[model samples]
Target: MAGVESAVPGASAGPELAVDGASNPDIDLLYDINGLTKSTPDWLDRAIGFVGEYGLLIALVVLVLWCWASVRRRPEPEVSVAGLVWAPLAAGIAVLINIPIRGFVERPRPFVDHSGLELLVDGKSDFSFVSDHATLAMALGVGLFVANRKFGLIGIALALVEGFCRVFMGVHYPTDVVGGFALGTATTLLLAPLAMALLTPVVTAVSRSRAGFLVRARRVPLPHPAVDLPEPRVADDATDTGSGRNDLAA
Candidate 1:
């Protein structure tokens, strides 16, 4: 209860909740989880923290591979490339949206509000309404999925892991992660279609150029037209008989 801190005015954050009397059940649950997590082994701490820190990179690799594979399998280079490109593009939009959401919610980080909370990673003074990490993770995931369901599912899993580690490491409340998940998912889903629609022409053009050699869609949008060959001709038997009679008269 003592040494509790809230976010600065004008921008709200998750202030310190009572150990037993948090205004929101989600915050209360965070306290219990963070408290228990403090006793985890050093290796586990690092493992989860590593996942939280670099999960995006891992997800990005998966996205690239999946996109390449999609192109290879279907040869629809434009569509697969769009899926790959839209992932980070959609994530960028989600990050932009997160800026205002943080100011609006003004939730403080869990470690800032609670005493004896240990940090596995450096802490930021930013408001914790929704986590940027979680949002981007999910945004990338959803965008990738929109491009290819298999890749999208993997991306979503990575996003969930990022959220879990953020809480487990005492950097965020569960609600922060949830808000990020929702924001990321919604932003990507909305933007993916628009991105695909707008970028398709560019992608199609690129596919025809020398650079198009690199933009393998793996699947062709329209198959080439079929060709018709000429039929063969043979001499008739009656013509051959007439030729023999002329030869005899000669």
Candidate 2:
């Protein structure tokens, strides 16, 4: 339960906690990555801890809202809105799905089994397999991507960083983060088409209602270019004068 402040250096850190005392890549990777925390300054470690635990997730939520605000201007507001709506829903569903898996796997926190790890945050009493943070982040990322490609890519990148943060924080093994990414991606991608099919019509209906402002804003009219008018022509006064003279001479 201790944090990076209590990290043990070198072999004195203790023995491998793998089952039957056998070493595996998962734990090895966990230690290798978590080990980096010890090399970093405590302030830096704390910063990473805050970012991994909360900052990135908050950014993702803002990204979703940002995406929603942007999609309203798109030609297909209904489609975009439907996708944006699904992003959070997917994250929620993914986290809910992880609950049963966590209970079934009952994997303990990395700090519980391993020693000398630089745990960034403390009081992690729940199971560690398929981290909820990673799951929620990736689900939102993938779901956002389904709605808007540009923003979605940013979301996915953040989610990947989030996965690394979990391992770096010493709360989860690399595989655990991978499992979360897999769960989130699969759930969002697999059910996306169906979700879109159902949600689009509802969005379209909203687009037509007084609440349409939520879907799309009024279009701004473009200004027209200026043009010069031609001048009117006038008959010569000489012709009229000559005609009068000829009549007087006659």
Highest lDDT scorer: 2
Write model 1 residue lDDT over 1-250, tens digit each, in one string: 1223443345432443223355768767777766665567778877777777785557666666766665645645577777777778888899998898777667677666565565677747777778888888888888778777877787788788788878877788888889889998898787767889987778778888877655663344787788777777777899989999999999
Error of 2 at 122 (Å): 1.7
TM-score of 2: 0.83
| Candidate 1: regions farther than 4 A off | 1-23, 217-250
RMSD of 2: 5.0
Give model 1's TM-score versus the native structure: 0.74
The Cα error of candidate 2 at residue 14, in Å, is: 22
Give candidate 2 misplaced runs (Cα > 4 Å).
1-22, 224-250
Tell me the tens digit of each residue's lDDT in model 2 across 41-98.
8889899999999999999999999999888887878998999988898899999999
User: TM-scores, in order shown?
Assistant: 0.74, 0.83
Clash count in backbone of candidate 2: 0
Worst 10 residues of 1 by lDDT: 1-10
